[model samples]
Target: MHSIAFRLVAEEEEGRLMAQRVERRKLRDTINPFELPQSLFEKYYRLNKPGFQYLLDVLTANTEAPKKAFAISPIAKLSACLRFLAEGGYQTGVGKDCDVSNKESCM
Candidate 1:
């Protein structure tokens, strides 16, 4: 009886450890809009650098992530939004181009 009880407790502990384990996610690579040439940047996002900067400044507060680790930058978020608007593609496709995950794109 004692051996059976010990085995059950061990199983319970194993289950708890399994429950606490988090799945590792692959971090997608995001494009840097600033790295693009002026014409390309305008063509992709439909906004000039200055205009994009202005919008970023205006929307930074709302777009900023609370934590830096594993958090997307405000610029990346804005670029994703602009790219979505400019291309008029499905969110997943645009997000893929912008290096955003499908789950984040849905949000």
Candidate 2:
């Protein structure tokens, strides 16, 4: 029936939209601290990449696994946290810089 066909088409469209969203996220989350210019890294994180990685290592030395599925990378999480700190500790600002949703950055 036309109704069934229309429902299938709608579902396919939804799936395609979801795939695009996932693709965008995958692209967004590939940010790497080492790739950033040293000046920019220091300005934002208050440390160079080596220093940041050292600090991250010390901080996460005893960390446990996250209680969520598909957790963000440590570097990404640290970068977001540093961005939050640098940008007056604003969740929305950090989210914008990190290409994450405000809710995700807050969490």
Question: Which candidate gets the maximum TM-score versus the true structure?
Answer: 2
Native-referenced Cα lDDT, model 1: 0.68
Off by over 4 Å in 1: 1-30, 62-65, 90-107
lDDT of 1 by residue, 1-107 (tens): 99999999999999877665422223233346776779878887889999999999989755545575656567767887888888887564444453333335434
**TM-score to true structure, per model:** 0.54, 0.67
User: CA shift at 45, candidate 2, in angstroms?
Assistant: 1.6
**Span of 10 residues, lowest total lDDT, candidate 2:** 98-107
Model 2 spans with C-alpha error above 4 angstroms: 66-69, 89-107
Candidate 1 TM-score over all chains jointly: 0.54
